[model samples]
Target: MSKVFAKRLFDGESWLTNQQVTLSGNVIESIMTVEVPSADAQSVDVLAPGFIDVHVNGGGGALFNHTPTLAALQRMVEVHAQYGTVAMMPTLISDDYEIMSQAHQTVCQALTENMGGILGLHYEGPYLNPVRKGVHNESKLRKPTEGKLADLLDVCRLSKLMVTLAPEQVPEDFIEWLTAEGAIVCIGHSAATYDQARQAVESGAKGFTHLFNAMTPLVSREPGVVGAALQTDKPTWCGLIADGHHVHPATMRVAIAAKGCEHMLLVTDAIQSVGSDEKEMAFLGKKVLRSNGRVTTEDGTLAGSDLDMATAVRNTVSLIGRTEAEALQMASLRPAEFLGIDKEFGRIKVGYRGSLVALTDDFFVEATWIDGQKVWG
Candidate 1:
C-alpha cells in the first residue's frame, strides 16, 4: 500500500504539487501528485527526502564513546527519527584501541539489524593531529602506520567506513592504499599545509570532517587545507556544523559565496547531549559544560554540538539565507552524493528507498517515513 502526502514534493529538482504517492513494502511504488488518491490517502504538511546525517556521535544522552551498544544506537535513532532524520551513521571519535574496535564492530552489527535507516559508520579518528584534536582524546591519537592501517581496515570490513584523518599524519605512501580500499577518506582535525591537503584531495579524499574547526585556517600565503578543500578542481566537500556556534550564519554566506552549496555539506556533529535540557554533558572522558549554548570542555576546548538534523536544516534555511529546499538538499541530497549513495537515498524516485520527512512551514519535522513506513508523525 502507498501513502499519499499533502502539500509539495521535493522531486529532487524542484518542489511541486498535485502529487500522489504509492509505497510497496519498503520502497516508494509510485508518486502521482496530480492524480486523486484511490481510497487510502496519508496526507501531510510537506514531503521531502529523509535527512542524511553523516556525523552523529551520540543522541538521547547515550555517548558513542561511553557505550556503542545496540540500545544506545536505538536511542540515537529514535531521537533523530523524531527530528526527521531517517538515515544516519554512528560516529566514533578518538578512543582507546579496544574501544575503537568495539565501536566499529558494534556499528557493523547494527547495520545487520537495519534499524530504520542506519546506512553505515563514521570513524572520526584514531589517526589525527594531536595539535588539532578538538575534543577528541589526544593521547589516543597516532600517526598512521602500515600495520595499524591494515588492522583498522580489517575492522571496518564490509561496513561503510568514513575515516577523518590528517593527511600529514598518515604516511604519504599510504594515500593510494586507503583510497584503493574503498574508504571514504575525509581530511579533518588537521593542520596540514595547502600542498599536503591538495595532494590528498587528488588522491581521492572526498570531504572534510567539520570545516573551520580544529583544522588549518586559510591564509594568503599558505592557503591551508581550507583553501584546498574549497578548490574548484578535484576539490573536496566541506562538512559544516551549522549550529550557529560552530559556524555563524553570516560566515557561511561568505564561505560558500563562490564555492556554492555543492562544495558544502551540512553535518550536525551532534554529541550525546542532544535532545537534553541539561546545561552540560560528558565528553572526552570529562564533563563538558555548556553555557550560553556553547559546548566546550573544562579546558575551554570546543566539543561536539547539541543540534539534531532537524535543527541544522531549519538553521541553514532560516538563518543562513538559503531556501528550505536548498537547506534540505545540504542535509540529504548533497551528503548522499558526497558518500556516493545518492542514487539510492538522496532523491525521491521509482527505485529509491521511500525514506522521507514532512515538515511544517517553520522547517520543523512534522512527520517522518522510513522505508515506506510511518515511523514518526
Candidate 2:
C-alpha cells in the first residue's frame, strides 16, 4: 500500500485540505481527512485526478493519423504524461481506408499489451461533411454506409471507440446503431440546423466534438449546431479546444454558463508538436506551422493545436475565470464521464484507479502517476 497527502484535494466535486489517500496495487484504498497535516505523507500543493484527453491527434512529435504504430502510440502517451494526462483516446483524423485499417490494428495491439495511458481510439472523421471540413481531407470524406460502419464497429468490440461524424451526413438509425454497439457518436464538421442536431441527440449522439470550430455557428434564427449544443437539455457533452485561440475567454465563459462544467469538456486537439521542439509538422499532406500559440497551415487553416492538457487546465482557470477545482474537473472527471468510464478512472475515491496528478499552486504539473506508477515529472 501507498499513501499521499495534499495541501488541497479536489475530491471530484469540491476541495478539502489536509487529506490523505491510501492506495493498494493500482486502486485507491481509502481517503481520510486530518485536522493536522501528516509529516511523512508524500505530499504536494494540490492533488487532482489525472487529466483525461479525448481529442489528442498527436504528441511527442508524432501524429497518430500519419503513423499508426505501437511505437508512435507509446511516444505520444509518454509526451502527454508529462503534462498530467494519465489517460487519452489517441485520435486519428480523416484518412484513407488503408490508413484507417492500419490504425485500427495498431490500436488493438496497444490495448492488448495493456499499454499504460492508452484508454482507446478516437476516429475523428471520414464520415464528415465537406462544407465545414476544416483541416480534414475533403477527398477522403464520405457518408457512412452499412459496410463502412460494420468495418468500424468491428474494432469497437475490442476497445473503446469514439467516432465523430457530421449529423447531416449520417442517417439517424446509423447513429443509434453505433451507440448500441458501444461507440460514442460525436457530432462535428457539419452544417446541420438545430432540428437536425437535436434529432441526432435523440438518436443517441452523446457529444459534440471540438464544439464551436468546424461546426455551423448558432445564429439568432437558424440556430445551427452550436445552438443545439448550448440549448440541449439532455446530459449531452461538448468538448472545447480551450487553447484560447479556438475560443475566446468571453465565449468560453458563456459556454460554461450555458452547459456548465458537467456537460462540457476540455480537449487538447493537439497535433505533432506537443513534446517536440519542431516549429512545423505535416497534416493531411500539408505543412502546419506553430506560432502565436496556434497551429495552422500555409493557407491559415487552423489545424489541430500545439496545446497540452496541463496548459489547457491553466488556460481554463485564467482565461475563463473558473476555480482550480472546476478547471481540473473539466480536464479529468468530466471527460471520463463523457466517455462513460468514470467509475474506473476519473476520481480519487476508494476503489478508483490510482491515476493521479500532483500540481503546483501555480497549476504547473509537478508530477503524474498512472495506475499507481509514477510516469512523469
Candidate 3:
C-alpha cells in the first residue's frame, strides 16, 4: 500500500483540498481529508486523473508508422507520460494493409505482455475519402474489402479498436457491423454531407476525430459533417485539438457551447515531433516540418501536431476560457468515457485505477503515476 497527499485534488468530479489518497496494488483504496500530511505520504501541489489520449501518432522520435515495433510503443509511452498521459491509443494514419496488420499485431503483443500505458490501437484510415484526407497518402486510401473488414474485426476482438473512416467511402452497414463486433467507429477525414454524417452516427459512429479539421464545415445551408457533429444528441463525443492552430479559439468556444463539456474531449492528434527535439521528418514521401508549435507538410497541409496533453489542457483553459476543472475533465474523464473505460481509468475514486498525474500551478506536469507506480517526474 502507498499514499499520496495533494494540496489540491480533482477527483474526476469535483475539487477537494488537503486530501490523502491511498492505493493498494493498482487500485485506489481510499481518500480522506487531511490537515497534516504524513511525512511518508508523497505530496504534490495538484493531483488529478491522468490524461487519456485517444489519438496519438508518435512521440519521443518514434513514429509508430515508421517503426511499428514494441520499442516504438515503449518510447511513445515514455515521452507522453512525462506530459501527464498515463494511457494512449497509438494511432496509425492511413497505411497499406501490410503496415496496418503489423501495427495491430504489435499492439496485441504489447497488451499480452501487459505493457504499461497502451490502451489499444487506433486505425485512422485506409478507408477514408481522399478529398479531405489531410496529410494521408491518397494512394493508400481505398474502399474496405471483405477480407480487410474481417481482419479489422479480428483486431476489435483482440483489443479496444477505434476505426476512423469517411462515411461516404464505406458501405451503409459498415459502421453497424464494426460496432456490433465491439469496434469504436469514429467519423473523420470525410466530406460527407450532414445527412450522411448523421446516418453514420445513427449506424454506430461514437465519436468525431479532430472536430473542425479535415471535415466538411457547418455551412449555412449544407450543415455538413461539422453540422452533424454539433447537432447530434446521440451521446456522440467530439475530439477538439485545442492547440490554437488546428482550431480557432472562437470556433472551439462555439463547439463547447453546442456539444456541452460532458460530450466534448481534447485530443492532441500529436505526431513524431512531440516530446522530441527533431524539427523535421519525412512523412509518406513528403517533407514535414515543425514550426511554431505546428506540424505541416512542405505544401502547407497541416500534418499532425507538436502539442502534448498537458499543453492541450492549458490551451483549453487559457484559450477557450474554460475552468481548470473543465479542461482537466476534457483531457481525462471525457476521453475515458468515450473509450468506454471510465469506470476504471478516469477517476480517483476508491475502486478506480491508481493512475494519476501531478501538475504544477500552471498545469505543467510535475510527475505521473500509472498503476500506483511513478513513471515520470
Q: Once superposed on the true structure, which residue ranges of model 1 sit more than 4 Å away at CA?
A: 35-39, 154-157
Model 2: how far residue 243 lies from native, Å: 1.0
| Per-residue lDDT of candidate 1, residues 198-302 (tens digit) | 989888888888888888988789889888877777756888898889877787877778568876888888887777667777677798887775678888877
Model 3 has an lDDT value of 0.91
Question: Ranking by lDDT, best first?
Answer: 3, 2, 1
Task: Locate the minimum summed-lDDT window of 10 residues in model 2.
Answer: 148-157
User: For model 1, what is the alpha-carbon lDDT of residue 149?
Assistant: 58
lDDT, candidate 2, 1-83, per-residue tens? 66788999887888989899877888888899976656666888999899999999998888998889998999998999999
Better of 1 and 2 by TM-score: 2
Put down candidate 3 lDDT per residue, 1-377, tens digits, no spaces.
87889999999989999999998988899999999998889889999999999999999888899999999999999999999999999999998888988898899888888888999999999899999998999999999886766775555666689999999999888889889989999999999999999999999998999999999999889999999998747999999998999999999999999989988988998998988888888877788999999999988899988999999999999999999999999999999999989998888999898899999888899999888888998
Model 2: how far is 268 from its true place, Å? 0.3
Which candidate tops TM-score? 3
Candidate 1's TM-score: 0.95
Ranking by TM-score: 3, 2, 1
CA lDDT of every candidate: 0.81, 0.88, 0.91
